[model samples]
Target chain A: MRKMEFAEAIESALKHAMTNDPDIFLMGEDVHTLRINLLAQFGKERVISTSISESAFLGAGVTAAMAGLRPIIEIMLIDFIGVAIDALLNHASKILTFSGGKWNVPLVVRTSCGGGYGDGGQHEQSLWGWLAHIPGLHVVVPSNPSDAGQLLLSAIESDHPVIYLEHKLLADYWLDYMGTGGRENVSFDVPEKGAIGEVPEKWESLPIGKANILREGDDITLISLGVSVHRCLEAANILSEDEISVEVLDLRWVSPLDKEAIITSVSKTKRVIVVDEDYMRFGLSGEIAAILAEENISPIQFGRVCTEHTIPFNRHLEDNVLPNVNRILALARKFKS
Target chain B: MTLMREKTILELYEAMYTSRYLEKIVTQLWEKGNIYGEMHLGIGEEAIIAGVLSHLIPGDAISTDHRSTPPFVMRGVDIESLLLEFLGHPKGLCSGLGGHMHLFCKELLLTSSGIVGSSGPSAVGFALATKYQKTKNIAVAFFGEGSMNQGMLLESLNLASSLNLPVLFICKDNNWAITTRSNEVTGGVLLDRVRGFGIEAREVDGSDCMAVWQAVETAIPRLRKRNPAPYFIQASCTHNEGHFLGDPLLRFHRSPKKELGAVTGPLTKSVLHYKGGRLDKRISSVSNVLALIAKARAQLSFSNDPIRRLEKTQTHLKDQFAQIKLKVEKKINSISERVLNLVQEEASL
Candidate 1:
């Protein structure tokens, strides 16, 4: 099987969905940068370029979904999604309940998130936690090219609005900066060179709210999503040198969280460390810790490794703020189980 | 404009009268505290609703704002269901989850939102679907001049025009955003601002039903043709009452009756002198006297309420308008009783 880049896999998945469903259409600013030229390939009617009006286009997507079309609206960056917060939070999330189930908004919003380059404040934040906090929305953060492809397929098929977040740093070009440049055990390779793994030849759809157990162990369960999942995997490898068997869990679906898998892992390991790129306060890390605490899992030792309260634009400052393998390993060592 | 039939003109009049009567009933019910929460009523803007909607077909979609009673009434939405919803009955629209502001009738392809400027983008979506499905249906978005400055509405204008969708953006200019005059808040000519997007934009006197009717009727053909584009209609009407039912009127130094009469005198005269069709005998009789006493009274007293004008106009038709109002009143009463039972049942639950 040949490896595929994360962005390429996303484009392939959208193309497959568009080929299969005549009702599917795409709208956003500069989707071509994401390697999507469905306007050229599938006709301009299927792939639409919208003005930088996030609220209107997002509302248009919700309306299109209500009118019986599956629309994929893209926000260039998750940070800019705040402009459409009213549409996303108030309209898309509540239309079904407010209408008494008269409407089903099968709209998918795809956008890039997380900071690696020094893109300053507006482009660097990973607010998937805030998105997950909103009920009635399916928040999916795919860590690898394969899951990115499959999860997008599932999101398009979902009966509700799905916010699909792709990490800007996880693309093939940025793998050079991720530790040691495609070297096994040292470098975190991207989709190329079989780092994230090969996408299936035929498009496959995954379940909306399931977690993947990357490495099974009993000492500690490391839970994370998106790019942090790779960091956890790297951390698990590092902890293996110390004879600390770490179980790495990739939470693909941040919302409708895979609580069963988390409980099963937390119960088996009896110690857990949740690693998240989002801000620690009022975010996914807290949610995970609260979930474990509420479940009353006996002899449990819980900790979290998340981004600092604020992220700065400076590259060194961003490195300190964002979670890394060293941070995950340090948290794991600090957990006194 | 093609000559509208005598029956069609009377039907339009009946629709306008129905909207006015419904708002008065809403005020009565609201004052008595039967309807919970706030209600935005278009007391003197009935002509805009009756005129534009007179051309609507079943498949066409319309999105409206909080001031949406007139459109729903024109669409023949169930009075019992609407009243029950306003009273928060479990059997109401949305099963009592959404109040009157969130009323949506799927069967009628009508959805009303409480948020201002929201209907513009939603109607664009509806129009996008119609164009994609290759249907003759068009989508109409009804909002006030107050919401015309909203970013989303302007964005929707650009989106609709760029996509060449079959959407009609109707801005019912009541000249007030609550107590603020629209001109004081809105800058430049609205028609020119909309035409900046290279889309067709026009204005009409909302007091004249025939003008509104003619404008919408003319736009329909262009919207249905090949490579159809979005159309904009700015119907200038009068805000006869305060923003909400409970809004203070003393601040404006005017009573509701005076404000209503200031607008209704010219509107009633226009409807009476309308030369499109054969008038009802009573309406013709009013036109004869309308010229002599048009300016004699600036305020309508309780006995000379504009709502009673419909009764006078329809006397030749066996008091049909009066009978319809009675039917609505009975239906409202029955719905209120059902709502009371629902409230008790829910409380027990």
Candidate 2:
């Protein structure tokens, strides 16, 4: 096992996957950041740096994947997905289904999401809920370094289109920038506990639809994913001090959604609090609540702590809008009471 | 002027005739209410499809717009499956889920979509795969001139040129986008627009299959090179059926006096309105409307039909033309009979 940062683990996964498969190629705008590492190692043929044309490049990646080549395309930011949604939503996601299962689009679209960087509205968005709502897409969001590396490999290997979202706060650049006395020496606060972990040296792909039980308890269950999962763990630890046990469930895959794990956890605790970084209305939290209601595993306490349906711009307002440890703890305490 | 072999010319003519006959049958079926939904037929674009696809081998890939039957038929996709798809059969291409607009043939490496300008990106992807595999196979995209204005298509042109991928973009400029004249919405010259991306651009008379064949034949060698670059061909053709089958413009042109009688009173009142503008300006506007209608009528002339043009050129081989027509017609008639029986079987079930 090797201890690596979130970014290093993702790079390790990509390097390993590309070295093993000759058909795998990476294309995106500004992917040349790995020029010395991936471009030099794989050559310009495999590591391509395209212009800022998302629809063209992403759609090209989709068709390339369909034509027997595995293409890993990076969309830079989730906010920019609107420009290329037709390729992902219309082509990549629906190609296999529309082709009567004759063609398979084994394409991976890696994009960064979440807010707190003060990068304005367009740059900061966690729209995984919107992506998961699409039928043929698999949405994977990993909180820790190990899961990030493993889930990405699984996504690359899957015979379907995968939307892999990385939280900007848990990214390597953010952590490295913060460590080096960030801009103006202002330390932007973010959850760092789940950013680094020990990844297995041997390449291993985690199943796409399984949730990890990060913390086991008999009290209320705290369900979340991506950066919010870290906050749930933090809240679980604080609640343990007050003799209140909280189970933290890290939902790794949002689309194939580990419903069995959710039902088991919610059934055991009989009280659940969903902490989501995405919007509150018609979002992940509502989907979870509906699942519970449909399963008739109700007559139990249920609560949610999610971001409002507003864009995050100002640093202070973003912090308030995004779910944090305080919000998880507040909801957990209310469920316990 | 590249001279094609007599055998090759016969093959191209046969393919074009087959497509024309098939689409004509499909139009009849649609008119008789056997086929549902809006049908976009490649009636006048057969010369372009046969000219480009005739040179393609099995491994070569093709991506096309909504009007894809001619290319699909010319590429050797199963005719029964295609006809069954038009009839909405479960065993049809794409299991009838994708109507005439969306068709897929895995063996031929062909795909079609109803979305506008999507063929460009799809062809780029196919060409990228060809480069990765280090093959001589090339990818082709067939779209209308209106699609040239789409951002994705322009972006695809830049990507293909920058990557030096083997992609041939064929723009069939039929002078119209549905009901609107393409020149009014499109800007500048299309050949110049494509040349701006540093790719070689050529134009050809789409009604002349020999001209289109020569253009593609010349481009194939450069595209099959080790370091291949993308190419563009702007083939100007006329859509005989306007945009789709039963287009109102075509209906208006069939009996101009009868169609105009219903609207002449209101049209004159609107054009000569006393409160709107000057009398001279209104009169000039009426003249412009009349000129557009006349142009539309002129485009539907039999001179633009590719089948007649090819037959006219092949007058010396009259016996060969007659033999080819009999074979194509016999094949199409059998296929049509089979499709009708299958529809009957399905209706009973």
* Model 2 chain A worst lDDT run, 10 consecutive residues: A175-184
| Interface RMSD for each of the candidates | 27.5, 26.6
* Ten-residue stretch with the least lDDT total in model 2 chain B: B269-278
Error of 2 at A13 (Å): 59
Docking class of 2: incorrect
Question: How high is the lDDT of residue A255 in model 1?
Answer: 91
Write the residue-wise lDDT of candidate 2 on B150-255 in tens digits.
6789989999999999999999988776544678656688899899999999999999999999999999988999999999999989888777765545656887
- Per-prediction DockQ comes to 0.01, 0.01
All candidates: TM-score of chain A: 0.92, 0.96
Each candidate's fnat, listed in order, reads: 0.00, 0.00
Give a tens-digit lDDT track for model 2, residues A231-288: 8888888999999998999999998999999999999999999898888889899999
* lDDT scores of the candidates, listed in order: 0.74, 0.81
RMSD values for the candidates in order, in angstroms, are 23.4, 21.9
Write candidate 1's Cα lDDT for B246-302 as tens digits.
443321234446544553553454335423123454344333333213322221222
Q: Could you tell me every candidate's TM-score relative to the true structure? A: 0.49, 0.53
